[model samples]
Target: MKISRIVLASVLMVPGVVLAGENARDHFRDEARAATGELASELMQALQAAMQEGGPPEAIAVCRDRAPAIKTRLSLERGWRVSRVGTRVRNPLLGMPDAWERRGLAEFQARHADGEAYADMEKVEQVVEDGQRFNRYLRPIPLQGQCLACHGDRDQMSADIRGILDDRYPHDQAHGYQAGELRGAFTIKAPVD
Candidate 1:
């Protein structure tokens, strides 16, 4: 969900401070939303195609190989850091949340616990890291019905799917998710101008 300019302006406003480039920050947030939406839609299309052609095992390969490629392509095209982070990661190299992301995930979880719909959850902020400032955005990725083939309960998963996951991710922890649960988040960080 895109944050409204009125809400952003209200949040950034201070009693005696002059804020600058409010629209620039809003543009950055919109770009992040567009990139994240593209990645999610593309991955879903690919996953659905793979599932139809070769079932759950092929879908796993698509996520393992193609997902990272998609993220890399988006990062190059947008010149921003774009990736997914999971609460329980299947591939730690790609899906592990960093410290800042962990904090964002915690915030998401807390909001969800307080009855906020996951579909409407998002966080946007600016922070300085190592003398560089960035606009960071996070949105939760809710697990859908189709995701159950690989991400659902392991005990009920097919043997082929289990075998592939075991071979590829010896230390996987991304299963046991139900529909509508928080699978992970799409995170984007663009340098502030």
Candidate 2:
């Protein structure tokens, strides 16, 4: 039966993954990338849908509301994370994860935003667990004329829009970012062990 074949295939794959020859870190990293891609794609769709349906306010609200769900699912499904660094807000796992803690996001912000240097694109990998690896993919979040309505200077941003950003993320560092300056990263990670 198809079910049996699928189960057999799944069982067969587990050993190879746990096998010593194959690097667990690389396996986890690859898995994490795939997972992150799927999650990010879904979230992007949700954001776009909110924009079309609820407008900008809805778009922002949807993202704010869904972040926790995303984090929880990532932890449960992959035993990993979907998180942001450089956030003044506290994350319980910020320093407690058995194999995670990378400043890739913080580094990007520090160099690009504070240090006044920006890269059009960047990808860096770090070992979070002995065999697991995490990658941070970054690109600039530029400001377009259209975006000025929500994210530009105070004079340009309407009070409602500013309030939205303020309400959801009181310690937001996402502001003051431009189209070509690195906003942050799309981090993909998995345990090496």
Expressed as tens digits, the lDDT of each residue in 88-109 for candidate 2 is 2223333122222235545555
True-structure lDDT of candidate 2: 0.53
Residues 31-138, candidate 1: write the lDDT tens digits: 888999999999999999999999988898899999999999999998999999998999988899988999999999899999999988888999999999999999
TM-score of each: 0.88, 0.58
TM-score of 2: 0.58
Report, for every candidate in turn, its global Cα lDDT versus the true structure. Answer: 0.90, 0.53
